[model samples]
Target chain A: METSAAGLEKAIKAIKIGLSLPEQDHLHRELEELLGWLEPLLAFNTGETEPLLFGHEAVNVLREDHPQEGRLAELQEAAPNFAGGFYLVPKIMD
Target chain B: MELRKTTVRQAADAVWKGEITAHQLIEKTLKNCSVLNEGLNIFTYLAGIDAVEQAKAVDQKIKNGEKPPLAGIPVAVKDDLCYGVLPTGLGSPAFSEFISPVTAAAVERLMEAGAVVIGKTNLDDMGQGSTTLSSPNGPTVNPWLAGRTAGSAGAAAVATGVCMLAVESDSGGALRQGASHCGVAGLRPTTGRVSRHGLNAHCSSFARVGITAFSGEDISEVLDLISGFDERDAATAVCREGISEIIKAPGSKDITIGYPVTAFDYLEPELREIFEQARERFAEGGYRIEEVDLGLLREGLLAYYVIAMAEAFSNHARFDGIRFGKTAEADSLEEMYEQSRAEILGREARRRSIFGAFLLSKDNYGRYYRQALKIWEMVRQEFETVFERCDLLMLPAARSLPRSLEGESGFLEGWSEDLYCAPVSLSGMPALTIPAGQVDQLPVGMQLVGPPFSEKMLLAVGSASGSTGK
Candidate 1:
């Protein structure tokens, strides 16, 4: 697929990340080259083949509903902002 | 006390027989690690008194008449695997101070079996590239040769004798390629064989907790200790019991080994010669070798990157800097998210994430992502057909020798390095990489791949082939 700087920027925006102008340009060029390498993937006829999402086939094992002790204090210590037993985030509204 | 020449079996036996206490062994290992770390840069964090205390516990267990299989063996963990006690840097500056609340299940099992964790080793930025140069802790120098990349820090730690085994993760070919470069044995176990609990996910489907050791016997022993079902990781439901019995069943000369002739075309001349010698050794060892075709090897490489990157993009969504990692200061919520990820993630991490977003976008999802998945199915089917005729497949672990530290490799060039190992990964099979021989004084490795849950058979064959040890 063809890629452009604007299209690439839009994709990056969806992921909630920002890059400098030069970095964006470099990413676009690299993506274009990488996509070219993937061109051979289109040569095969996969109309009848189903997509394999995982490497192995396994049924998900479920556990009984139960509450367990949580490591809230230790988890909070690694966070950048936390207070009053809650994670702190920048305010979205005034 | 020469760690380089010591095997895990010998060390554990010595400890069990009272020849050496676990505490004394750990003390000697710590001293060796300190001296080696200054020059090799293999460890990012070295355990201190805590390691000694753990070893003492093992000694107490022996006093009580309990014999642990991995007694007094020192192991190193890749930084990406969470250990709770040591800060898991994930090869990024943003996470240099972040610590996991829980340890990885694989590492926990090793400790339970009497293996002491020496430290956390370095890696590529979030395990993106094969070369460990992108780590914030600086690159791990190759132990075999100076001014060369170790490919992965876990391999270097094992090769340098800082640790007897290394718990590492491999999404594509990082573990195998690193072992090839450092001249050691690395095993990427069958998907779902080992638990992924507490591991920082990069590519959920392909990413697996693997092991690197000095010999195939060590790898087999450790695999038995760690491979089993864990309710925490649903994927491990596929793992069955009796793995110990299977791995210890003894190597059989009646098994058939499949050889992919066309795949050798990708190897450099000198490396190809080494692989040929390994093939001859296998044949001389009494195993029947048969030629097989793997037409989708190159196509599998393409599909691997597409699926791996897309999964990585989804997994990395958790690293928003709010729950973990250092958050960048910004005026608004949107800017906070943007600035934090932009500043925290390295170039390769960001580049792959952005490309992943593009491939999975609505416009390109069917054109690229869906097509790659279909090709992935074909690749798996191809391997399944080949395995029907042969019990094992032998291939080169790497296409070329480790590149020099002074040279800068382009992104494509780096990706091409995975040409040989990625296809086996895409098949979701178990592969064991052992030191075949050396070229120009640099070690080369050959991998033996088997069907899913065939790790035991692979290790048995690998040990018997006489390709292990530098």
Candidate 2:
């Protein structure tokens, strides 16, 4: 079944992507094709089987909650803007 | 001396015996990089001077009468692995300049064991595809056949003798597929067998740092150096010792190997011939082969793709140009994110994220995402049952010889290349691919899969099958 153009537009909005109308149209076609490929999964009745969230069998590892020295310098370098050991971003209060 | 062709064990022995200096080996490897990169385009970033310095350090250690496990061996790493000195591109334009401030635990162990980091090899952008064609850098060409896809850039680097060992990752058979295409051996250890602390998150649960080399013994040497528990990566298994010791002479035990027709139905004529010959050889060697029904395991590709796309959607949400990676100028925060991602991510990455969002959307979550996970669990359970009756499972690596690079658009869909290996990944089991033999001059590989923590037994079986020529 073809994905409705309106449905794809809703999906694009929900996903928070930036695309022109032409690009959206192109993506609509691709999404429809991909959905068709994914159609087989919907047909299988999974019943009460639980999902395997993590593939490995290891137990959850816990560490202390105390603050420790982190890679602050590296984080600052990767940040878009930093000054006086603080991150700068568009004003949220305004 | 064909220094480039020197195996991991041979190089260490030579360096220890003072027959060759690590500096000379690094020089030869750098020269190989220059001559081969034109045809194969293997590495995304070469550690030219930095690699030499590391090699010099190894040579100094050798002169002092110390021998490291991988002494002075040149190794290639996938671009996504975090190396503080190397600029990690992740094969995407977005991360072209992203230098990791930290190094992977596995890589740290390798360096400690005396392996020299020669270069960072290319990969599909964010490891989204099997064919290594999605890179903003040109697709890696197969060294064996010019203009054919180098299934994994690291695989090509190892095959062409540019690097003696390669560190790579596999989500959906990228490691095995590339190894098969390039006529080398690659092993994807159990999901948590190696640390993912320094590895980029792409299909996080399914992705693992895999080892690649020309032979099984070389792969085993590297695997022993890297596999262990890490406090940083919470999912790592408890430290297992003596993994390298298991690569001993192939045992004489009569092994039972299970073959499923569902997996073999897609094999091309040439690969079928190779598969038959391998089976005959195993039989002559006194191993028993039993054919089994794959059942739900046949749906492995669909389940793997759905889960991978959904995870990718969440994993890539961090790259909005706000924190890291290349950012585009825009007025609003959302616009900055949208524009930067659209400009930076490749077509496959973008499509996957969108499809992933669609799968997890309110109306589709139960129908798509949950269903795929259920199937994932079912496939795992089915394999658990199969393993009970057989010592190992055998299947063809690629359905056919790799497709030509020119005859196709760079985009790969349906993921047919991963048909054989993804099921093992989904179950988080270990699979070792051996270059079983060649078909029509193209290499063909057979995978040996066992239950979790079966690396030693799997390698022993592979070694015994004459896959490593040990």
Task: Name the candidate that leads on TM-score.
Answer: 1
- Residue-wise C-alpha lDDT for candidate 1, range B203-268, written one tens digit per residue: 888888999998788897898789899988988887644333223233456688899999899887
State model 2's lDDT: 0.79
- Write candidate 2's Cα lDDT for B265-351 as tens digits: 677676777877887887777777888778665477789988998888888887767666666777877777788777766777777
Give the TM-score, chain B only, in order for the candidates: 0.97, 0.95
Each model's TM-score for chain A is: 0.78, 0.70
Candidate 1 residue pairs in clash (backbone atoms < 3 Å): none
Worst 10 residues of 2 chain B by lDDT: B240-249
* Cα shift from native, residue B286, model 2 (Å): 1.6
Docking class of 1: medium
Q: What are the clash counts of all predictions, listed in order?
A: 0, 0
DockQ of each two-chain model:
0.72, 0.54
